[model samples]
Target: MKERFRLWSRAQDASPPRIAAAKAPRAAAISSASRRPALPRGVRIYAVGDIHGCVDALDALLIRIANDVKSSPIRNWRIVTLGDYLDRGPSSREVVERLIKLNELNCLIALKGNHDVWLDTFIANPETFREWEPWGASATLVSYGLDLVSLGAPDRCAALAAEFARVLPREHADFLRNLRNHYVCGDYLFVHAGLRPRVALRDQKEADLIGIRQDFLRHNGAFEKFVIHGHTPVEAPDVHKHRINIDTGAYATNRLTCLVLEGAARRFLFSDTPLPD
Candidate 1:
């Protein structure tokens, strides 16, 4: 079945002609000979976008990635997940378990998303459940065999927190505690959300790294690195001179995207196969 899946490259003509014109000024303004963003020679990075607990999609995508590597081997490769591995889907528990195992293999670089951080906050202060509930917290709770109706009582914040902490596996807690805010590779910065304009990458705040939207999205200026991020859902992958957003709302749309960067080429692999609900 993995053999059937193929790497999908963005057609050169797929992008509107205006996009090049829009980006030309920024590239020229940055540097007269600014070359296309690229990774180190012979290195390949497969960065997966917001999982949102879609384990089936994650599993399928991993298989596709494995097949790609087997067919075309590279010496130095990395699989970086752009976070949101929990919430919004039916398999949050399974998702964490899979990620933990993958991390142990030393090939996975997991970045933290706002939802993943919220899970930690929710575990510590269940009062935050109110904030998370609207963003698919109940699905995660249910995945862990917790009854939302019982946990959702008006005054059960402490009780809910205690119950959650007790049920959460130790490795899972460790995984959440260890998630990185961002990762850099060659000329690309992989972050959960877009970066704040004009801020140095080293000084970016955690909150903005996993949550900020409009300010970063609206900024037309260039940054120190070409950013590849998730967090905001778009109908399709949004690629520009500055950043690439690969979050296609996997929890709802079932289209889990993985952006592939090898040298100067960019392509995509997707796990859009429907699974049983």
Candidate 2:
């Protein structure tokens, strides 16, 4: 299947005229020299930012992505989610389930975010709850039908872990455990957080992949691949020559963003409008 995707990506390189012909006048102004990095020829990617447990936004965003793809009809497509699939919002459990379902389609690539790791850590040792709760573990506990008070009790670490083990869906556990730190597709690298500056991609410290902030963000140097990441929240997608940040703080701002990439063109689909319950 991956080989098929590669072949398809290569075919897209030959049809620049078709792609250009479809571009709007405003987009046509994008000079060839200034064009954003291109994906492999036939491959298209829809990369979503930190979900932060906003299942409603996630659901709506998936609809928007589906509609966008349906209307545009791109083959060899893949969906890359920049993680933080749990916490902060009202439906962490549901968000995990939704991603699990999406992964079943065989095209979804999920990365691990710090919040996700925190959840796992808290589950194994509820003593971490003191810090985790304030970081948005309360909503995750509530979504799991667990009592925040009970789980947060000073002496209940073992009990909490046991309880969670009994009820946590195997599927969700598998999904979380199997998540990657980063994904490289064509010329873009998808990660939950930023990468360390001056380090080879292979030599990167794993912690920085989902935790680094100031250092990575401050560096203006170019990376081998255009890094697309989302550990840091932003009011809007930060598009730069070397990287793109799409985390729009969905848990609080109600905006879940998806960055779409086809050849060298980039666009976005956002779910900010509230969906009626």
Candidate 3:
């Protein structure tokens, strides 16, 4: 399995077509009555949306980010991935491996997404494979060298789970276990999914942090901090007065998004040309 992963990684290392960066139209003009939300001086953030196991797209975006930094350098910067790094795509194991490698260099802050949580649960309780199957869990299993044709039976779930646990690298398990629920920096709150409206940051539940949808999406009121998140897929990066959604549904659309924030300004980098808004 390890040798297979290495070969896959090498194959993915071939250069992909260059991605472009575009400035998002400003969401709103700053009013004299209220201060614009800004990161602390010298800090810039590159927050990536749900990966969903698209390793090739992930590779392109990371290269674009590195190029962006070279062209416009900042001493204090971060790459925060708004997680969903598993399932729904063919390269789930490779995706985790790539992130784990980046993390070792201290260049990434990976948050937990709903699909990622499913992986943890599946590991502990193989019975949950029944629940995860519809959400591309089979793709993930295949990524780890599992032959679904042989293990696809409902009765084989436990055997499949045991095989997965045995084949999964210890480091990969450690990476998933240690992923953060959310990360706060200056005025922006980074989460996998949107936070629950009206709930204090300290009081927000993990369930809501990874899964809340309509309540977080429909709220027009300001959050405790301006939020940057991904879970729900948007055709484009949905920029509102209060938050930004960057998930472009990589697995299906092959378009991944990276929301670049510096001071109060916002722009985007894409793994492929963004679909028409």
Candidate with best TM-score: 3
Name the best candidate (by lDDT).
3
Show model 3 residue runs off by greater than 4 Å.
Answer: 1-33, 273-277
Per-candidate local distance difference test? 0.80, 0.78, 0.82
lDDT (tens digit, per residue) of candidate 2 on 50-97: 998787677667766665666677678989999898888888998897
**Of the pair 1 and 3, which is ahead by TM-score?**
3
lDDT of 3 by residue, 173-230 (tens): 8898898999998888999889889889999999999999999999988888888899
In TM-score terms, candidate 2 sits at 0.84
TM-score of 3: 0.89
Prediction 1 global C-alpha lDDT = 0.80
TM-score per model over all chains:
0.85, 0.84, 0.89
If both were scored by lDDT, which would come out higher, candidate 1 or candidate 2?
1
Give residue 61's lDDT in candidate 1 (0 to 100).
Answer: 75
Q: Report the Cα lDDT for candidate 2.
A: 0.78
Which window of 10 residues has the lowest lDDT sum in candidate 1?
Answer: 16-25
Clash counts for the predictions, in order:
0, 2, 0
